[model samples]
Target chain A: MEKKQSKLSIVTNGLLHENPNLRLVLGTCPTLAITTSVFNSIGMGLAATFVLIFSNMAISACRKIIPDKVRIPAFITIIAGFVTVVMMLVQAFVQPLYQALGVYLPLIVVNCIILGRAEMFASKNGVLDSALDGLGMGIGFTLTLTAMGFIRELLGAGTLFGIQILPDAVEPMAILASPPGGFFVFGVLMALAIMLDEKQGRKVDADPEKIGCAGCPNSKNCHGEGGCE
Target chain B: MLVKSSPHIRDNSSTQKIMLDVILALCPAILASAIIFGLRALLVIAVTVVSCVVFEYLYCRLMKKPNPIADLSAVVTGILLAFNLPSTLPLWMAVIGAFVSIVIAKQLFGGLGHNFANPAIVGRIVLAVSFAGRMTAYAYPEVTNGVAALAGATPLVATRNADLPLLTLFLGTHGGVLGETCAAALLLGGIWLVVRRVISPVIPVTYLATVAVISLLAGQEPLVQLLSGGLMLGAIFMATDYVTSPYTLTGKLVYGLGLGIITCAIRFWATSAEGVSYAILLMNLLVPYINDLTRQKPLGGGKRK
Candidate 1:
């Protein structure tokens, strides 16, 4: 059905238009900490995306049976199961990343991205749509995490995934690895995201009251709408 | 018939009134430092205050705007900024800090509540980074039987690594800024502010708790961390700056917790033994966001994160 196809669109749109990490700003701690290296970023991103998809699928399947009173608890329990699985697998196989993401690995349960998608999307959507939504959001988070990691590692350590980018003469700012630097980097990136959104005619926060030049008689009443005159 | 508004009550509080109380509250610390550190401390405080007021006045005049110096907020910033610096810092550097605080941090950012970080802390950090030698240059006053300590590592530096006597740190025997040496004095000022309702305990108390818990975990003496360096001054005064801190009680608690956690981490593990100023500045930067996130809507209002 056309309705079903559009429903699927909602799931896929999150990959860029409504990305959980980049666009919506969910789960920032992992974005800041694990993004110190590209490898770690990919690892953390894939891990989080896996959790998000599974949690969304489970939450979607259980939506009808879940009581409104305890929906949050139910969703959290489902998300926690996937997060635990991710943690065990990462520790067993990816030992370096496991160590780098200490405490944050367990903290995935508190990540707003998975929980937000589960509550906002999976709670109302069908199983297939929910799974796609999870996949889209998960990949979006992964891409952002990888980008952040690439940047921090490239500048802070002068290497991208252990490859030297900058010369040895250039000294990296020690603060880049610290928490304050993490916040600064994240703030700048968010500002950049907002600027990019504007450039692409997304109009995420457009005011409906304002009239464009098309509605004006002489084009003098432009209403600052892209200087249409 | 005139339509009456739903709410008719108006409180006695204003931004100017709160800023005035802050100025008055810092007086005891300023006077105590002047008495203990002698003419130099008084000179430094006077120059810092006058320069801040002048800079603020001239900035507004040049910009063709109404002057904000009448409210004495610049005076409070000057006094607080002086308190953070070593008494031995050259008067010119202190003046530069005043200019940075008022012109760059305050006015350039649209004044008062507009700044993302505390102006004084930013000024201090600027001096700390740019003129580390002068900023860290401390001079112990001539007291009975003991030689005056010169510019060197602070008690926090010593305490960060080894066990320091709580009593020595509690009193003003350690090496730090003139105002920061005595925990009792800072506490007295904090208590006065609280008694006068100049500042709420939400920030100071929460920030202290965060630092205490983190330091305890990091194998540092909790009491020593509390008493050493600028922790008390930062918690009591700088962190509680009305314009740069969270408005709601829960938001303040969260901000304070973040400050304390970061401060303790820096003190115990990072290169700097003192992290209070940096931590407070960082939290001050987050205040607006916290206010936004924790903004409680009117009863039965719209809900969003």
Candidate 2:
């Protein structure tokens, strides 16, 4: 007899409780490196989703046939095949996006989120559950990446998907457009997410114990508990 | 109930203390600048410090917050800000920089360690954009002559426009900001800060190495690049800022290297000559993720993956 978790749980889990980007913090390189615009985020997210879905299905189908001893290698091979296909398709049709994303497009092959899902959930679950998990996770990642893209592009460049969202009089915060700005936005958003979760009477994922450099020399006598907040 | 109430040893370190230590370590550079630029340096420093402190005080009071200026953080910020600017910088510019550094960069982001980018760098960049000619225009101290020296190009300006002598740049005879004019003094201050345990050595060493390597690769004078402009000041002070810099040793090295590489690229290739400020500001934005990736609790002590 199979015990069932409702599908709503699967979707909501990705949205917050089990968010791949915020909670697990997987796919961070792409999240930080390529999210300079809404288009980039959408492109990265869709490409990753496609890879995730196919990889999840392939891994689940061959889970039993593949030996446990070499499961990691087997998983890598499957992921590589899907990623190669994604690369060619992007190069052919979405060349602009492929150019914008650069190396990060191919890096999706090793993205921790896809690999993490394959190792933890896809391998053990039935094909349907695995498919749902991939879809939920894919959507969650797409939304988060897009949100980050929206904030970075809107504030950094005064554009979202290349459309101006702010008045001309307002000076853009140029730092938000650069790599350091990306991390700053990422931290603030992550902190806000935790705060909102707590306010909504949900279990917040933020652990002050784990938020920063805890034992760092600077942390000991600086900023109350850490050097700086 | 367990009885244990006698005078227990409390850690003497505090944000205020660390900030004060950094200011003290920076005193040499500040004093050196006062000597070089004379009363002009003192006036600029005073304006910067007072404006930064006043702005922070007013903002906190307006925001209905506790007086954060008591921590002496704004004081440190002011000193660092003055270090980056030319000693002959107009009083209005320094005051404007104070407002921007305190209000926009520091207070807007919730103050102190919460700012994403270093406040001093932000203020410098704003000044650079608003007054490009003034920001880059440099002047030598008028010690021999009675009259104040007119504006002249720094070694970096010379390097960009017409490559200058490396030795002259190193010796600080060339035109530049007050403190940045003396590479030797900045190095001494950096060493003092490191020895005092005020800042780690990773950032300064790695940042310098990266810039040196990149400069060599680009067929430029590595020594000149190392000694010119704000590279020393940025690497030693701004890049090592606790709130904006990475924490772990590995992360700090990576952060420093990244800053150096970015700085070299901007200086040699890009149009901007003030590369240090931009590079450190960019690295500051990356601090959180750097700490996240590098901060590993002891094995068996770590939270679940």
Candidate 3:
């Protein structure tokens, strides 16, 4: 009963407050690549989410057994196990999506969001909380990618998920569907997200720390007592 | 009048006055663009200018900041962006260029003084990259000899490949962007800006000198290289932007030299026709580091060992 009150906040935090794509800005490699279409965005998001939940649960369950010294390797091994499962499931079921995602599906094993949460939240939290965090963050990533894909596809290709959206007169900007197009959409979306936060008297500062901390060897170690946020 | 309540110093120039001076200085080139490219070019300029000012104002309103269109900076950016575009470019595309200039490059980076790079250059590059086919479709004015040669290609490419005469290239009787064709007019406008003291001669002089010397050494006619494309306009205007270029003279020299070298490499050997825009953009990004490297010592001298 006591944990239930904070449960809602944790999920919401992943959805809005600490969204992996917009707020956390993790898993951007996949986001930029997969956001050309709504289907790819949803597929990638769900696949990553599935991997996240299981990995988080697995990591949480073994948190005590895994030593602090080699926890990173252990976490990777566990996450890789789930990612392999996801790759197999997608290949067997949705062959087209598997083909579309290509090497990226296998590349999901190294996604920062999964590895990041494993280090930050799941390792320190209970199974239920970890699962919810995965779900919320996954949904947030899904929505962001879908929105970007929808805009890019509509403007760049004049179609949405292979359906014609714009009329023939409007010559779509094909660049929006390319890699640079992905960046433009991602930038516009990020700006809008920051602006919305500002409207509520809170600012979303794109501090370099969040992204920089991921690859840092001393991420776990604070400068002194409480580490850099 | 509005004097401060203490020991104070002041300068007569403000953002508005500087912007106004730039606009005045740009008039000669603007007139030349109209004369050379025709009335359609004027339409592009008007559309871009209005859209840029409106976008700036709307952005300010949405962000709940005071209106910034009064500064006339947007107007200057508009003219510069229009100057980069071909006369044949669609008006809606010009509007897109304005949005990119004011909103993405200007407002999103917290406006004017805080913007990372020159907004006009970014806007023009974005448009160029996004619509390469449209952006490069330079509309040639009625020139007798050049009519058979590239009816729609920019002169930089044609000059390299085709047997285009240096005289024709010098006299601006070829297809190119609005400001690039008229070397004489750009020189006049650049001289006016220099005389007005709105900018120092450091960036433009160094940039042009580097390009000329390198071009001569590389066995290309320096005057032909100088007069052919947007080199004069860009070296004069875009490279000398207040908020983006380096502050120290040493920093400005390095930045200008870098730009010149890049521009020469791209034009002589690379695939692209004109590299002035990209050269300036890249150098603009390096301004902070250049400033640090060329930072002036204190008047009394306190240097780090």
- The best candidate by lDDT is 3
* Residue pairs of candidate 3 with colliding backbone atoms: none
lDDT string for model 3 (B1-305, tens) is: 79778758768889999999899988988898898889998999999999999999999999899898989999999999999999989898899999989998999888999888999998998888878888988888886654565545666766565656776666676788987787777778788888999999999999999999999999987888888888988998899999999999899889989999999999988988889999999999999999888987789887744
lDDT of 2 at A28: 89
lDDT of candidate 1 over A1-229, digit per residue (tens): 1235575566556766676766677898788777778888898888888998888889999999999999999999999999999999999999998998888888899899888888767887888888888888888888888777777787667888788888976544444555655765676566566557767776554233654543322132123344433
In model 2, which regions exceed 4 Å deviation?
A1-4, A88-92, A164-175, A200-229, B1-67, B82-152, B159-305
Highest-scoring model, TM-score: 3
What lDDT does model 2 reach?
0.81
| lDDT ranking of the models | 3, 2, 1
DockQ per model, Cα: 0.04, 0.05, 0.56
* lDDT, model 1, position B52: 92
Candidate 3's displacement at residue A14, Å, is 0.6
Per-candidate Cα lDDT values, in order, are 0.79, 0.81, 0.85
lDDT by residue (A79-131, candidate 3, tens digit) is 99998999999999999999989988888888988988898878888889888
Candidate 2 lDDT over B178-265, as tens digits, reads 6787777788888888988989898899999999998899988888889998898888888888888888988988898899889988
lDDT of 3 at B165: 72
lDDT of 2 by residue, A1-229 (tens): 1357787776566776567887667888999998889999999999998888889989998899989999999998999999999999999998899899999988898999998889877888778777788888898899889999999899778898898889976556666778867876787677666666667676543445765654322222233444244
- State how far residue B230 of model 2 sits from its true place (Å): 5.2
Task: Give the interface RMSD of each candidate.
Answer: 5.5, 4.6, 1.8
TM-score (chain A only) for the predictions, listed in order: 0.83, 0.86, 0.87
DockQ of 3: 0.56
